[model samples]
Target: MNVSQIKIENHNPYAVSFKTNLREYFMNAASVEGIPTVEYVSLEELKFLNSQSKDIRTGNITINPEDKEEVFKALNIVDRGEYFDNETIKDAIINPTAEGMRKLVGITDKFTFERVYAQFIGLKNNGEYDISNRVANVLERRFDEIQHRIFNTKITINEHGFKPKEDIEEIKQKNESLETTVQELQAQLAELKAMMVTASTPKKRKSKAELVVETENTTELDEVKE
Candidate 1:
């Protein structure tokens, strides 16, 4: 492998989405973070930090254990393993597209414990929390399932392979037959309706010519009697 061709191995694509979910989860924490101590996306604080760091995009920070604990305590957040289990894994498999599963896996694969801890510290003063290690381990396994499901193309739907031509022809024939039957039935119904209309109307009375013929025969019979 050429040294010049080497790629930075730690580049992660879904970082923005991961960070957004983390913010939401932190807001929901039952501890200190349960209520917004301040507004989300503290622009002033981030700007100050950005000014201090050489790499503003991923600024460095130092966090002590006590600080970690306080941050975790405030967020009421616990270790990754504390929250994840076999049942959770099963559910994650069933709902692979879930945001929580995606975020958990993204955080684990994208960021280091120290770096993540620093991020938490940047937002708060207290520390006693470390989610990176636990999240990384649990998510590593969970993400494997997601990867398998995504890449493994063998599926129930696939088993029924796409027979588009045959299936379409079958449907087309059924539709044509049904249409013909409907047309024939409609014609028969129209004929029956015409017959019913004709039967319902009264017949006209005898014509005047027929009445005159009958009157002449009656007069002849009267004259013969006289």
Candidate 2:
């Protein structure tokens, strides 16, 4: 929760890469011998990493609890050094007039809100979600809204996990219904084909007019007289 620095070491033997369109970092080259090596990354970078992966959370990469100036120096976190006067910040928090304290609070709130907002954006676009309603007091209401949206039964695993037995059963039922419909259609087609074949076959029925014509005509009369 430090406002200044985030120091971490990649314990993996090979380099750990965190790449995105906005930021890419290759951190923690393998340490030599029994000695330890650590790298200082910014809080912003840590946020990005945490949102995308569980490295920081799951103990793959550990962050130092201590705050240091190396965070600002190693990373381009603060573009304007003049605007980020450490002494002034300390004074506002330590020995503040009412206006100074209010200004500091406003700045801190704005920063926190924006960071949480970025997490939401990451969730929407890339399915990288991390919302802590308990830790972030200012963003609790918004986090609750997001949590509801994520935990709704209608949602998929794109943002969160939803693997209820009901969903599986519903899909199975739909498949069975579709199979039944297909079978019915095939039966109807077979019946129609059978009717067509029956209609096309020649019938052996004789008409009464044919018998009267037979009576009028002699059967092989010329040949029989000879």
Candidate 3:
């Protein structure tokens, strides 16, 4: 969305837009933001009333905990876990990007946060604090959910180690199948060992009757051969 390419509809062909980038944008009448958001930019204001006159904290519109709480009740959100990742709400206040907003607040989408941020900026520059009802409805949803959890305090939404029941069941079944296979293999090995032992046993030799060869010069085996 380039501002240069946009062509405005001229209800009256005689009206012309003046070009001036040197002056600061401001308004107290029908400003560029909020209820009577009639213009794309504000008109002009006193030198001290400029946004540059305010400090970093005071100048910013209410975007998060660090800024004012006019836009919404963002300060109610309390990050319980390591979801902050060592980041403070000030980071989100300074730069209300999707990720920063997600970390600060438990909201999933960035569009609503961005919309609220626009209001933050608009109000900062003396714009209106008009909030759309649609955005307002779900704005504090995360805060409410966090308050409902545990000890009724805000917390980070942790989505970790979530597995479907089917996957867990499959793993359990696989383990059972493996155990059964091992048991079968052990039984087969024991049977094979018993068979080998039976086959390898030597048959007992028949007891030879006492053959007493009374010959003085011949042995028992010589008598048998004769």
Candidate 4:
């Protein structure tokens, strides 16, 4: 049978045999026609699949402990409200380079400088640095805010981004237009229905006087014929 003509029959609703029939049908169809298998997945399953795919795409990452410690220390220093005149420390942590580290920390020892630079590189690669992760977090927050605004206030993101103040006006205009169209259609439909009812209903019977006149005319004609 053609794919469109194929039907699933589930006669025993209470029995588990109905599922067996469905399975057999799909298997047989696939074997005979080389049809692709179809499977239903729950939302959780779909989410897991997406996460797996993302992980595969991201691949494996290895973090160096020494680098992690140094990066953590530097971040801690900044967290304690310490300020440095050199932008190199900030730039190095975000996008570390050997030259930048040397200028920022004044580390003339080759081995020490290399170690610190390696830590910065590791942090940058893992997206664990302040610049990247902080920015991502901020953007995520903003998106959540936008979502809340959209659903609660009927605001939509247009070319200019979120316009909470103008959203009400835009929605009102659209609602008014829709209401007007609905009213016009209702009036037109009412008129058409009235016309249909008038056309379908039988005309009222003639008055008794008119019927009597017609009957008398018929009788007179009949008498003349006789």
Candidate 5:
């Protein structure tokens, strides 16, 4: 009953012939009234269909309502008619990437970030003012992708030992240790210098005392001779 041994014929309805036992089992399982019709689909088509079904089950991309409101407020659409054309606005709404959204704003005599955002809102609200959630979804996904890339790049750099904070801290600790060692050495040198001074002072006093004793002895010898 190895299913892999079943011969799959490449024809309309894509016939699959199993062994006698399997065939008998299928026949018995089926109602005697009518045979079920078989449909054939290509592997590629099946994969495509599965992917589509998965996406539907997962649902389309969605951005938060608060985020949408923030984006709209940032755009500041004071006069909607000033910056947008019908077709360009529609295109921006369909594909709402930063660059794509910029096109909807059109060529302006004066342009600013806020102004560009405003134009984007203006375009979305142009006809029915009913903006698609898909646009927000696209924007949210794009921003998430960008943030993820930046986070990964930072991690990669850190793995290579190129982290700024860690390097700086290590260098700082080394400098502090060096400074402590230098201070200890200086303290040791001062102690040695003090010992040398103490030792030399006693030798100088002894030499002076011996000279006086020698002078007194010589005077006594002269007196005794006289």
Candidate 6:
């Protein structure tokens, strides 16, 4: 994939065009790689539009629409921009990157990681730091024990980097397990509610000792009168 090219039309100040060597980011698996896994909108684009236009829109993130409002509130403080909930603008600001190029394709060099890391740290210091630290944190895990449970000898951290397949499988398994557990809990809850409703209905009580004594006394009195 080639680096993305952005074109801003002089005619329409509000609308910006984005072109990438890779396919467009979509909601499904087909465009999963294209999708921005980080912020809602690109910080680099926000800064650019802020310079060019008056009333630059802020909080215009739509990449993660579900939590867009919350994200907007968090990011709106930067560059004194206006918050726009409009879908058109939101869609335009795809994959906001700290480095100004949110979607970088055809990566050739190892320096890309450092550049991304530096930009990420800068943005984080600016209070808009949210990236895939799970990948990074997972990379930090190591085996430092003298004797290992699985292996008799000392275990060391594997120098080999993480593979995409392992991460994908782990995510898939977790999701499936969570879904199954949710279904089971829902079924159990429904059954408990049904049992409660059945138990709550009024039931007839047996005659009390006081009522039986009163009836015997009345019968004795009637016999004596007879």
- Among the numbered candidates, top lDDT falls to 2
Q: Which ten-residue region of model 4 has the weakest summed lDDT?
A: 54-63
Candidate 1 regions exceeding 4 Å error are: 1-163, 207-212, 217-226
RMSD in order of candidates: 18.9, 18.4, 17.7, 27.0, 23.5, 19.5
| lDDT scores of the candidates, listed in order | 0.39, 0.47, 0.37, 0.38, 0.39, 0.37
Model 1 TM: 0.25
Query: Model 3 TM-score?
Result: 0.25
lDDT of 3 by residue, 20-122 (tens): 3444432233222222211232212211222343211222211222222321222233324322211243234433344444444553334333333444344
Best by TM-score: 2
Instruction: Report the Cα lDDT for residue 147, model 3.
Output: 44
Residue 67, candidate 3: alpha-carbon lDDT: 24
- Indicate the residue-level lDDT of 26 in model 2: 75
lDDT of 5 by residue, 29-146 (tens): 1122223322232333323333443211111111122332332243232334333322344455543444554333232223222233343455465554545565554334433444
TM-score of 4: 0.24
- Least accurate stretch of 10 residues (summed lDDT) in model 3? 6-15
Provide the lDDT at 211 for model 6: 86
Off by over 4 Å in 2: 1-4, 20-22, 67-226
lDDT value, residue 59 of candidate 5? 12
**On residues 174-196, what C-alpha lDDT tens digit does candidate 4 reach at each position?**
99999999999999999999999
Q: lDDT value for candidate 3? A: 0.37
What is candidate 3's CA lDDT for residue 146? 43
